[model samples]
Target: MAKLVIYLNCEDARSQAAFYTEALGGEILNMVTYEAGPWSDMPEKDKNKIMHMTFTAGGVLFYACDSIGEPIQRGNGAFFYLSFETEEEAYAAFDRLAVGGEVIESLKVQFWGDLFGQLKDQYGVIWQIAVENTSPSM
Candidate 1:
């Protein structure tokens, strides 16, 4: 089976990747700047920009890169859903990701008996965090 990975295009991939690493308690596995890659002939301004980056957090892996000579159009069609085994983990991650961003929904017990919340990160990415209730009254 083929593996699925999330790839993001942003204005500042390096800063965005760093923010995610800190917020999600993950590490940047690999990163390459345009100047360091085959496209080393890129303009000076873009040379320092990230050409590619790989990071993992809470078992989730992601790829990101800076847009090359193009405008980024952010939409609300997709979001990253994260399900945790514990409320502590879910809450901590939610809080960290909410910094400098908007919280669509604060973490709380939903009708489904799970602790859940939604937010847009500082980098304009949406995320949904949840913790399933081990013992649901239903």
Candidate 2:
């Protein structure tokens, strides 16, 4: 089977990874600095930047890295969709990610009978969180 992993490019990958771990309840599995990688010849100012990082939360896995010398353009075409088993989990994640960010949809029950919400995080990453209906419909 093929596995798909989301990759993100940001100005400060270290800080981004930390923020994601805190908001999404995940641990950074591995992080490599530019200086520690093959790019040791990079400028001193960029040497300490994160070259790559691996993060996983609630079975979701993704990678992130510093944009280095390039510009990062935030896009609105895509967003992360997180499904939680409980309302508390969904609300907690929604609240955490909403800090310093804009809420596109508040967490509440939808017509489909599930708690859902959407937001753009402080780092400009959009997310949609939801809790599936646990009981059968009439």
Candidate 3:
């Protein structure tokens, strides 16, 4: 089986890593910064910026880095969905993710018989939290 890990580009990868840790209850595994020697030609402002960061949240490893040139834009037609097995767990996670962020939709029982919600985090990263229903009938 193939594995898929989400990668994100931000203006401040360091801050993003910290926020993810707090909001998603994860830990930062590793972080790399752009520096002299191999990055001599890069812009000065980006010299201290994060080159790469690896974090593990909810058993999933996510990768992030500072944008080289392009600006960081949220709601880029994508969302990172975090699925939970229990409704309580899903609601707790969703509430944490909504702190200081905009909630696109409050958590509620969806038409598909699942508890679902969407929000954009403080760093402009969109997320979807869900707990699927195991019922046999719709």
- Candidate number with greatest TM-score: 1
Mind giving the per-residue lDDT tens digits that candidate 1 earns over 58-115?
A: 7789999999988888899988999999888999999999999999999999998999
Stretch of 10 with least lDDT, candidate 3:
35-44
Candidate RMSDs in order? 1.8, 2.0, 1.7
Candidate 2: tens digits of C-alpha lDDT, residues 8-118: 898888788888888887899999888987754699998888888899866688899998777898999998999998898899999998999999999999887889899
lDDT of each: 0.90, 0.88, 0.85
* Residue pairs of candidate 2 with colliding backbone atoms: none
TM-score of each: 0.90, 0.90, 0.90
Which stretch of 10 consecutive residues in model 1 shows the poorest summed lDDT?
33-42
Model 3: per-residue Cα lDDT over 1-138, one tens digit each: 998889978888888878778777889998888873385588788788888889987767999988888887676688888889998888888888898999999999988888889998888888899987889256
Pick out the ten consecutive residues of candidate 2 with the lowest summed lDDT. 32-41
Q: Model 1: clashing residue pairs?
A: none
- Give model 2 RMSD, 1 decimal: 2.0
Give the number of the best model, judged by lDDT.
Answer: 1
